[model samples]
Target: MDLLKKKILAEGSVEEGNILKVDSFLNHQLDVAFLNEVGKEFKRLFEDREITKILTLETSGIAIASIAAQYFNVPVVFAKKIATKNLDKATYESDVYSYTKGRTYKIKVSKKYITSDDRILIIDDFLANAQAALGLMDIINKAGATLEGIGIVIEKGFQDGGELLRKQGINLKSLVIVDSLEVGNIKFR
Candidate 1:
């Protein structure tokens, strides 16, 4: 986690709209070796929990979830933001509002991929408003799956996402938390 904090301080930038741009290594571009370490950390964090599968949202979360799944030796299931013909008609769906996109999207996952017997671990690149994480949790609930935990690469501590999850008794782990993104300064907690 310290390595992640260092990475954020070294390569992460504060963009407009309080966005912490970590695309250099965490997202956009792929860093397999570093992500492998991240995966190992997730494994270490959740080793006490039972995890049957890894679930995540589309796009940004896919890479992080996939890499982490290697450590769990589990398959990754991502909710599709956009509908596709290949996706099953029978799916668990949830609506999520994207602060960046300024709209809501219906994320879906095939019911076949998840079941009542599954113990799911949710992984993502960032956590801000908790909309996406809630949406993924909705899908897990619909499938009657047990949510083992959530692993986040970076969490904006200024936001309420972490608190909300903790209040709900969700097992959440964030490698790095940015308490503030003041211009020319980045505060971590």
Candidate 2:
């Protein structure tokens, strides 16, 4: 996690609305070596859990979930933000309000991928408002699946997401938590 913290300090930038953009190695561009370390850390964190599948949201969470799935030896199921013809009609859906985007959108997942008997581990790039994770949790509940835990790469601790999830008794693990992003300065928690 020290590596990730260092990378964030080196390349992360703070946008206008307190958004920490980590496009260099995380969200936009792919860094397999760094992501591999992330995967290893996640595996180590959730190794004792009975994880049947890895769940994530599309766009940003896809790569992290996919790489981490290799360690868990489970299929990665990503919730689609955009509705497509390939997606089944019978799907589990949840509404998520994006703090960064400033709007609410529905995220969906096919029922076939998740079942009642499976234990799910949710993975994502960031946790700020906890809306995405809450939306994914709603889908898991609809499928009657058990949520084993949540793995976050970089948690914006200045926000309430991590605290909210922890209050709900969620087993959340974050690699690097940024406690502050004031005036483009990053403070770790």
Indicate which candidate wins on lDDT.
2
TM-score of each model, in listed order: 0.98, 0.98
Poorest 10 consecutive residues by lDDT, candidate 1: 3-12
lDDT by residue (tens digit), candidate 2, 1-189: 899999998888988888999999999999999999899999999999999999999889999999999999999999999999989999999999988789998999999999999899999999999999999999999999999999999999989999999999999999989998976688998
- What C-alpha lDDT values do all the predictions have? 0.93, 0.95
Candidate 1 backbone collisions, by pair: none
> Candidate 2: which pairs clash?
none
| Model 1 stretches with alpha carbons more than 4 Å out | none
TM-score of 2: 0.98
* Candidate 1 local lDDT, 44-92, one digit each (tens): 9999998999999989999989998988899999999999889999999
Tell me the deviation in Å of residue 179 in model 2: 0.6
Q: Note the clash tally of each candidate.
A: 0, 0
Cα deviation of 90, candidate 2, in Å: 0.6
